[model samples]
Target: MKKHIFTLFLLFNSLVLLAQESYFPERNAVWEQKSSSDFKIDSEKLNAALDFAKDNEYSGSRDLRIAILKGFEREPFHEILGPTKKRGGPAGMILKHGYVIARWGDTKRVDMTFSVTKSFLSTTAGLALDQGLISSTKDKASDYIWDGTFGGEHNSKITWEHLLQQNSAWSGELWGGKDWADRPPREGDIDDWKFEKPKESGTFMEYNDVRVNVLAYALTHVWRKPLPQVLKEHVMDRIGASTTWRWHGYDHAWTEIDGLQMKSVTGGGHSGAGMFISTEDMARFGLLFLNDGKWKNEQIISQNWIQQAIKPSEPNVNYGYMWWLNRKGDRYWEGLSENIYYAAGFGGNFIVVDKENDMVIVTRWLEPNKIGEFMTKLKEALD
Candidate 1:
């Protein structure tokens, strides 16, 4: 009887702690802020970290069209196939226990978020799994997508898990972008890459925009609607995200679904047209993940999916289901928690979730190379 009472007491304390961390902002409402001292964070150190982020802006043209072309200069035939935007100055927010502890620059400015859209793409897949639209991740893509995209024998073996992990090695052209041409290895010419034997679906990992778009396309067919709609209905609205955000696809990516035309969105802005969102919305998304897919009393996404999404895939210890893990791998950040996972895009946009610290850090237009040092300083502030 005494042990039972003790267990109940611990459970009660846990509930109280959760209530303390449950603050979430309403739509268009002023987000509540708390001082660094309120959370026992060193204000001086926190300011230093923010200053570091401000001092190191992304060294790219504000005109993203030029930035995209120049950044992917090595990739043959790479061009802006969709909409591009002129980015705002460096912006970000630091959320501690779902409350803003620090903010900088133009957090309200909506800008193109490049590959960070992959994380959002993967979230749609997670939603599908939760809703029983997808039975299992281990199921073969060909089983669901009977279209010629997965018709070939090699492609037929590609599973949803493989695609989510970016190990599918799906070789094909989608929306005028060829898999071989997306990001050809520096060591090889176009002829060599195009003629090279396709790696097994689950064996090799290659970051190809074409393959990522293929996942988006497949998910669209499965969901029977535009992915942005699914996200807005099930996620953004529930999380109180602003309506200014937009998800776009290539101009030619239209498809007939249920007797109506819908555009299949890209997983990233490699060829343009992905998620264009404000920093605050990105923070809300990050907060949802930090809380393990819950918003107040509602479970927006299943906890099981969140767990699987963050688990490192065998091909890359630093990558999960479209999320970048801070494991001691090629992309690992020195002096940060191994549990830190993030949504990273080109031009240094990132939504970093530090679960151990109950914090989410959104940094836009910071130098990509300086993230490690920035994170180290942020961690020091917490200490």
Candidate 2:
């Protein structure tokens, strides 16, 4: 009887603690700035977290367009997706209890957030699933994308889940780019790449932009509208994201849909066109996920979809539906919960969501190697 009473007391306390949590931000939500003392965070530790972020900035090329062109080493880099813009220096913001605890750099500057766009693409897919355009993620993509794109026997075996998890190895040329040309075997010669044995679909994971673009192309067909528009109406606008952001596709990524020329968006800023968004906007996105896709009283992304979206793929434990998850013990700070997942981009753009702490972190242009340390210091600041 004593044990039962103790359990009941603990449950009541948990419920009371939950009741004290802050409300989710509404549309055009007011930014509430609070000091470390307000949250019981150690001021010195919070300062250390800020200093660590300031000290560890992205040391890569300042002119991101030039950097991308030089990195690709191919003239195809000249093919602009949408509109390329100059990126700013390291910047970030931290939010606890839906209030800003810290921020740095140009939070409003619009800059390319490379592969982090993949998570947006994933959200679009979730929208499709919610609308019933997709019967099941396990269904073969070729069944719906009946075009020759997925006609090849090997490609036909690829499922939507396989594509979402980066395990599909889908082969084809998209927008004048070949599948094998993307992130080709680092040690192999041209001949070896051309004649390499194909792995079965869903058997191996490869981070190829070409295949990622394939997902964008397939999704564009399903929606019959520009993905940017889909995203705007469904997510960004709903989340009260700023109007400055844009999603871009390659110059040749345009296709005729319903008698209109529609551009199929790229999954990342790989060739210099992806999500050009502000850090605060990205934080809003993170906050949405942190709240289990709820914004105020409305459910934005279904909790069931969120669960499936974060489920680890067989081949990659650290990835899920385009989101980078910190599932493994060694991948993130030990002090943080394993439930933490983030949308990461090249040149160190990141939006980290921690449900347990009701925290959202947005960092732009931080050194990738120092993220764990940054996270560790941030965790220490709590209480």
Candidate 3:
């Protein structure tokens, strides 16, 4: 009788575990939706949160080309070097336990997701590490690329971790964009920045697209294939993301790899060209991270990589491997969990992953300043 009781206890635990498993949408299958009531969430508060997002759409021009140029007007010589798309109005998805709890606007409309591309770019590096293509993040980048990109004394000292953390301080030019020219200090003129000594790598944090592109270029050589293909075969396809998503680089960012000329993609759409993806697909990505890089049964990206990717670097508590953390820092969203991390882009694209709450939030074209408040509102609803 005691043996039979043990068997029943095991069966009961298995059923509970099965019940708590997340629902993953199959390729081309309609994603399942659940009412807020199903999750015991306050329906009125949830609707109010969605209404707030809709009411406060991004202030940028719908013609993102104009918005991109105007937004970066402070930077000299900035130009649209790749493709740009007119954006759709305030589109988003809120997923709880892998089922859509709330959705608004054109969730299927593909739009440019500027610097959020950096998070995806970093994913490629994680893949390389997982596959033994990169022995370690601590490995010097110069060891992999003996070419002049990492030639200088300062650049040679940079490691994969430095680039991933956006603290490489890599000095030099790539594809006609100078490292200092990307985003110069507000108080300094062109000559001041151009001649200034670069900070020691991994000691300072700076958000320069030129340096970001260098990382992309290095990873291209590391993977020996276009990043989009690597991502598609290994990640996006595996996650059942829609075929509409695209990754792009500047028009002149082509390089010869494996006897074929391929475009080395940028980590952002700063001067245009990064990720062009729909809201639903973005939610799918957030879901993958929410589950610690697992999709249903398969671990597409190792949990070790994801954990490292979200760890706050010494230089920036709010940043980790190109993903933004909600930890105490300049960019922290007050009243939110410090454990939350997200991918944010210009013109207000965000893919927020809330592991503590078992939720993912994807919002596009919402005013950049409103994210903190928006998140707070969403949290209130869930509470």
- Residue 28 in candidate 1, Cα distance off native in Å: 0.6
Superposed model 1: Cα runs more than 4 Å off = 1-19
User: For residue 43, what is the lDDT in candidate 3?
Assistant: 97
Pick by TM-score: 2 or 3, better one? 3
1-383, model 3: which lDDT tens digit per residue?
99999999979865764468788988888899999988778999999999999999999899999998988888877888999999999989999889999999999999999999999999999999999999999999999998788997889999999999999999888888988888778885788888999999998899999999999999999999999999999999999999999999999999997799999999999898999999999999999999999999899999999999999999999999999999988998998899999999998899999987788999998999999999999999978
- Span of ten consecutive residues with least summed lDDT in model 2: 74-83
Model 2 segments more than 4 A misplaced: 1-17, 26-30, 74-82, 329-335
Each candidate: RMSD to true structure?
A: 3.9, 3.1, 4.4
lDDT by residue (214-309, candidate 1, tens digit) is 999999999999999999999999999999999999999998889999999999997889999999999999999999999988999999999999
Instruction: Write one digit per residue (lDDT tens) for candidate 2, span 70-177.
Output: 656643323444557778888999988778889999888888999999999999999899889898999999888987888877999999999999999888788877
**Candidate 2 TM-score to native:** 0.92
Candidate 1 lDDT score relative to the true structure: 0.93
Clashing pairs in 3: none
Instruction: At residue 295, give the lDDT of candidate 3.
Output: 96
Q: Show model 3 residue runs off by greater than 4 Å.
A: 1-19
Spell out the clash pairs found in candidate 1.
none
